[model samples]
Target: MKLLLRRPQQSDIQALHQFFFHVIQDTYAKEGIAELVDDQQHEWELKKKYVAMDLESRGEKRFFWLAVDEESNKIIGTIECGEANEIIQQTIKEDLSYCPEIGTVFVHPDYQNRGIATLLVQKILTTLEKQKKSSFCLDSGYKQAQIIWQKKFGQPDFILEHFWGTNNHHMIWKRALPFQL
Candidate 1:
């Protein structure tokens, strides 16, 4: 399908919100964490907040990009870079509040494995480099996503063993500027 990658518009808010839930539910189910309704809701709320921050500050606080199907004009995927999340700060035991984080990378279930996420990430990295940002951090608690991130980013800089209990762990990666896609 033909896709147009661009900054989110005010009109795209509702569609984006729906897209977030669709992707989140699919991800939680795929990861076998479907029973964690509270986690899903928390994630949804965090994404919604990010979108609001992007809209209110016009990308000053957080920059977001949406992948829209050119024919359907639907938000099929999303990615953003902004201030480091609170959890990341707490985990790292340091204030990385000023650090830009690459987060909320999501793609519609129908669009997975099609390089949509990679394209969005490449765009964000390019934009960050243009903004003179030197480095960025990203974390993933989902095993599926951790595999993908490991492939693209090598080993994570930090691994919170059993962060999600049992075999489930959280991985965080920090990459410097001028990274190869």
Candidate 2:
């Protein structure tokens, strides 16, 4: 499918939020944690705030890239690179406030496994490379996503065993810039 990758506008907030909700819901269901409605709501709110910050600050606070289906003009995926999230900061136990953390990677259920997310991440990495960033961090708690990240990023720098609960772990990766795509 043809996709138009671009930074979102103020007018895109409503649609973006809905897109996020759908993706988050699908993700929770796939992870077998759909019953955790509160957690889902929290994640949705956080994503909304991230996009709002990107729009309000004009990408100064958090840079975002959206993948809009060219034919439908609907947002199918999203990715961003910005300040370290709370989980990353707490796990690393250091002041990485100024560091760029690549996250918020969400691809619509219909668009998953189609290389949309990989393209978005590449765009962010290219932009960061131009900015002369040395590295970026990424962390995931979802088992499905963890598998993909592990394949692409190799071993994680840190793994919080049972971080989420029994048999569930949170893995974090800090990769240098100019990485092979």
What's model 2's lDDT at 143? 98
* C-alpha lDDT (0 to 100) for residue 18 of candidate 1: 94
Deviation in Å, model 1, residue 165 alpha carbon: 0.7
The whole-model lDDT of each prediction reads: 0.91, 0.92
Clashing pairs in 2: none
Residue-wise lDDT of candidate 2 within 1-181, one digit each (tens)? 7899999999999999999999999999999999999999999999999999998998889999999999999999999989997888888887675468998899999999999989998999998898888888999999999999998899999999999999899999988888876
Give each prediction's root-mean-square deviation over alpha carbons: 1.1, 1.0
Off by over 4 Å in 2: none
Candidate 1 lDDT by residue in tens digits, 1-181: 8999999989998998899999999999999999999999999998999999999999999999999899988888999999987767777776565468999899999989999999999999999999988888999999999999999999998999998999999998888887997
Q: Quote each prediction's TM-score.
A: 0.96, 0.97
How far out, in Å, is residue 132 in model 1? 0.4
